[model samples]
Target: MMERTALISVNDLNIDVALRQAALGDRVLDLTPKGFDLLLFLAMNRGLVFNRKQLLEKVWGYDYAGDTRTVDVHIRWLRKKIEADPGKPKRILTVRSVGYKLEG
Candidate 1:
């Protein structure tokens, strides 16, 4: 008899917050608390665009008074972990002159 496994799997490539706790191939991602939260937020609202200011207010909790580089850094980090090629990503997509979107 073939044994059935209950383990959840998110494709053979990558897994983000929407993918949950599932096998995501060979890529292993270690996220900070803030990074995880940001991923969760984006994953939950896939296909929707969110500006850095909006993300800061919603994810970071409160309006940011400093440089918005924090958002850019986290986005880059997330892309590195989730995208097969961070240079040309499919999941976390950047909207020109706007913000970012999580592609489903």
Candidate 2:
């Protein structure tokens, strides 16, 4: 029997958590460690909005000493890789003062 792999799909984006890989159609995306973690978390949660603090703790761990703005930078990078138009993002939506959420 073939082993079934776990996958998170949001539109054209496909993430393989087990392999720690993400791809847009046939092209594999080059994601940083933090960037991949953030994407995996958001993709798993789907529509739930998570604040910077929450993201830092979840994606970067509670021991992280960096500013919450790190999340913003990662989010921006992720949008560029995933969204057809990073300027007008469709997958990762900003909740303004609240934070961000992945629209699956």
Candidate 3:
């Protein structure tokens, strides 16, 4: 198995994969299991857009039967937690008519 980095940094945010933790500066951000997974996925594949279907499959798994709207909801939740201003997100960006990607 390929070795994985224990920690990932996106801008000022810090993610510790082994502990499944996310922090910003001196504050540790509380993220739900799926929310952390979503953030990790995007942080891992920064700049690469993944449509709702792809996000659902990758994050929620192939066995998941939820609709694409689930991804939207999760993204909204994530932005609220991570973004300085959720209304104009700078990290998780929406690719119109396409998908979403993380930018640090």
Candidate with best TM-score: 2
Q: State the displacement of the C-alpha of residue 101, model 2, in Å, after optimal TM-score superposition.
A: 0.3
lDDT (Cα atoms) of all candidates against the true structure: 0.75, 0.94, 0.94
Estimate the TM-score of every prediction: 0.75, 0.95, 0.93
Model 1 per-residue lDDT tens digits across residues 63-88: 56867779999999988878889999
Candidate 3 C-alpha lDDT tens digits along 27-74: 898899999999999999999999999999999999998688999999
Off by over 4 Å in 1: 1-23, 26-28
Give the TM-score comparing model 2 with the true structure, all chains together: 0.95
Ranking by TM-score: 2, 3, 1
Clashing pairs in 3: none
Give the distance in Å from residue 91's predicted Cα in candidate 3 to where it truly belongs: 0.7
lDDT of 2 by residue, 1-104 (tens): 99989999988889998899999999999999889999999999999999999999999999999888999999999999998999999899999889999998
Cα misplacement distance, residue 11 of candidate 1 (Å): 5.7
Candidate 1, lDDT over the whole model:
0.75
